[model samples]
Target: MTELLPAAGLTLADEILLAERLNEFVQDREAFSDNTWKQLLSVMRTGSRWASEHGRSFLPMSRADLRDYLLWLQASGRASSTVSTHAALISMLHRNAGLVPPNISPLVFRAVKKINRTAVISGERAGQAIPFRIGDLLRLDAQWSGSGRLQQVRDLAFLHVAYATLLRVSELGRLRVRDISRTADGRIVLDVAWTKTIVMTGGLIKALSDLSSQRLTEWITLSGLIAEPDAFLFGPVHRSNRATVALLNPLSTRALEDIFARAWREAGPGKDARPNKNRYRGWSGHSTRVGAAIDMALKKYSTAQIMQEGTWKKPETVMRYIRHVDAHAGAMVDLMDKYASS
Candidate 1:
């Protein structure tokens, strides 16, 4: 590991002190989830590569070096959020290396602020997944429910459970056969034992709708996952339409996104009473979560209830999904609907 900064002024004793800090950073990484560790390493390599491009090394990077790196990212058309993540991760690396974090500087802060403002002014907003509302689910269920390929049936079930529980794609892919249980009266209850939000606490149990349970049962029966309770619930549906226990590994997050997008698009446009409001494009696994929250809002469910169901840690996050709906139902909209129409 290269020194984070010039060690010219430090004595040998100071080097020993710094070694302790470096050890702490190294040991702490051992506890990160595999996905997290991969991300951190990737970012670190990217930062180093960017530094090499400018004829410098990343470890001893200064605040100015970081600001330049961020500017380069902006110039290369990275999203503001991506720029923010890079800046944050680079800063954390610096801190853990016993150097001052570049993000602590006013210059670095101004650079990030500029990137954010530029994105907003240029309409370079991050695209949110089109909400997969209950109506879309109905249409998709209609289209994909019958004697389809093993993959198609699995996806139908995936979309249903995803919308009902608002589970992130990672959580959905992490689901195990053991996580599912049926009540004596035949109601299906899913125990979500692995979610990013509730990592510190134990998992929560979510109830599936009768329709969703039926779809899932079909997939489980088709895939033959019932025999292996310890295996992951979902796997790649091969060309032969068989997903045996031997073929069991959790679906990759990208694979899950592609699966959701496929089913959502294949179902075609939904039929809503509202004109020009059909959402049939650009759906992702996240659409299920967003759609679930929006549906709950339309049904007049409280924010707390929505958050509880979605396992969202922040009120502001879940509200961002339904704020447009709130705007539409405002007092002015009421006036426009009742008086202006007449």
Candidate 2:
């Protein structure tokens, strides 16, 4: 194994020391968020399997092997962005281990570039969540009012706040009772202390609509989380064991996604409003955020206004949602009739 060392003059003992330093650096660095950490681990697992099969260590894998891995990923039908992310992750891991990443190789870089160009030319777009429109919210609200169950009340509050605020599921899960305040106008305002975008700018304020405020008040009165300022705003409800409903367990992002899915199924169109029978398929936690952005676009709001409301720093990112709506109802379409008749 000593003969396999690269000609870079790194001794076996120096390699061990490098590994130790990397581990220490990882420990001291701020941790990635839960979802991001999970994604990184998944990418690592795939890369590990490839390295093992090729009888090579990830830290010292050859450029050819990395290029092959990217080709394999593309062949396996991974989205272009996902393939790019896997490449980026491999590069980061190699750098962390104090070695040159294979992605810098011309072969690997050209492979990535070719794949990206192919995706663009083929008109391949990333899959988007089916946004929950304002009408869907009204229907869900009606259903919750008739149910009158503790879980129903909680779901109502969550949906109302989530849609109105357009918060990501992770942010919604992190909401605390103390972060909420009532404005003099009777609206509920959320003091978002942390967000993916606001990590540097500190925090921002989001004012909930009147309907959301009413639902939140009802949820608080029923769930009894109002008494504990530190309690999670959207905690779990033990429907099976009613005694545990008072326990303030923070809901996971997956759980929040489930809530969204179930609500979407119940409120969407279909016979008896059953899951999978509705028009609202492919909806997820991001649906509300997408829907809100499109709604603003339909109301003729400018790009800047939509970006600020959605907390999107990138105009291109915000444009994706606007583009989806524009494809059907943009001003260009409205002008077609005038030109066609001439």
Candidate 3:
């Protein structure tokens, strides 16, 4: 008896069965974070709808179909990066289905290139959040220190820890009480289990400043969460009738953004100033991470040091956050000043 084999592999009784199993394995192995998955799903849905409207199928979409889709996206006022993501998502779908991806089409490539050139010529770029400066954090801390309000204490702790660790709002939201520990040096260390980077090596450790640790301790004591080790570190605070803290539930990303917005408003000049309408309009949950990177850059930390602290695998990503700061305080600025002033 002779054994049948697939074209690329060893002998198998049924090649179709092997292909099916391989497809399933590939699908299972490709995992994405919740937010990332949602974004990819959105892209997929948009692409699929476009394909359906054009009487085309997504699995074996042709290069011409993809080109048309890209043109459609551009016509619909999608950003170049967003259109690129959609193309990438379509390519991923094709690859998962064991078909050659249509991403290498010259027309699609030219479309993307044209969009980039147009954006640069028009001075268009993505909006960035205003980094939360250290001075702002200090001012907020002073105001919340003697307020004797549980929510204020929690906000103070949140702001300090956020600036210290540069944690994303999602990672901060997932923090559990048990994930934190006090070091012998009296600093608070957080064991970040879920982050965008550390999915394999268990997790990474981030340390909080002494002031942040003290504020955290006060919040925990006041919130009565010291006994509940399994509770979330940051939870909801009920302010309907009276201020009451809830620890059993984890804080949502929206809630974190609201907290940051409120802090920005309070940190500004007047009580009537609207956070969304003010200079702090772009400030959001990601501001802490951007601010921390800029702070490190202003302090003369090397690129490698900033990358390590931010847990960024790519130097280019880190550069994006600090480029503006570098423009003001970089070595070139000092050199230029020395020559120009003389």
Candidate 4:
């Protein structure tokens, strides 16, 4: 193959290196897949093409070039948030340029503050734990069945474990059968070796064990999951002959989001619970995880204890989920009254 020309000192080989770095970052953070890296590369290529057609090939790109490319994406009907992904990728390219910026010292700056949407809502600038409820979860269980598809049983099991263990959709989707251990009584136990949260100190990070072991066992036995350990715990719901095992691929994260959207619709809204006009305030698959956290909190589990079940490293992330469920707002008042009076 002919060598691709360089853009901002990134040859096709350098782009590959950056893609590797992107993969490591995503995997380490338990984020999206390698496909996201390809999207970022496409963004770079688009910017390079614009520059080339305009006769501005240079070793380092100007901020103007980046801004123009972002404008192009916006004009193409991308959302502000999606356009921001391209901006972030471009920023990473500048950081990886291997040369220091003019008059700037080479020093690393750690993330002192990540975005805290929950904190903003509570009239504070700190992250709030997302809130989730058991009722909401039962409703989601119903929504999974609404698809009326073949893998309905398998999909239900997947949704149950996700809600019961509060697994991030990414963790839930990536689970291999080997990641689960079966107890003598035939219960399913999950050993989540990786999670989205970062534990800087590292030794003895908390985990969820057998949260839904009993239910999982029932689901597996009913679904006839006798596959080998290396098989995917969840796969697409398709049909096949006896000679070929009909296997399902892991659902994409985007697909999971759509599932939640469908659930929110089926659950509908309380008569007076409109978030804005016709829009309902709180509902989604994320509700599965956040709702579990809120249920535990309302059950009087301490904040730290809730973090253990939710597998949240920081109280802040847990707090975000807490706030999401707090949209109803009465639970906290009762919680405060009971605790404060005590």
Query: TM-score per candidate, in order?
Result: 0.84, 0.86, 0.84, 0.57
- lDDT-better candidate, 2 vs 4: 2
lDDT by residue (221-312, candidate 3, tens digit) is 77877767887888776673123444556777878888887887778544543443233464589888888888888998998998888778
lDDT of 4 by residue, 1-342 (tens): 323223345667776765665456556543434555677677778768876877764235554455555566656655454565666666555454432221121111111011123223534332222233567556656565444343554545665777777877877776766677666765566766666553334422222235355445544554455564555666554464111122456667776655555545556454544353233364545667777787887776888988877777789877766664446568788888889999
Off by over 4 Å in 4: 1-39, 45-59, 64-84, 97-132, 139-150, 183-187, 197-211, 239-249, 254-285, 296-318, 324-342
RMSD of each: 4.6, 4.4, 5.3, 8.4
lDDT per residue, candidate 2, 1-342, as tens digits?
Answer: 112334145788868866785696478446556666567788889988977986766656678888888887888887799999999888766666666678888998899999999988987776666777888888889879645577788888998888888888888888888888999998899988767676655587899988889998888777787876888888877866231332355687778888887886687653433333233465588889998888988888999998888788899988877686668665787689679888
Q: What is the alpha-carbon lDDT for the whole of candidate 2? A: 0.77
lDDT of 1: 0.80
Q: List clash counts for every candidate, in order.
A: 0, 0, 0, 19
Residue 11 displacement (Å), model 1 = 6.8
C-alpha lDDT values of all predictions = 0.80, 0.77, 0.76, 0.55
Residue-by-residue lDDT tens digits, candidate 1, 75-151: 99888988998888887777787766778889999999999999899987555667778998898888888866888
Candidate with top lDDT is 1
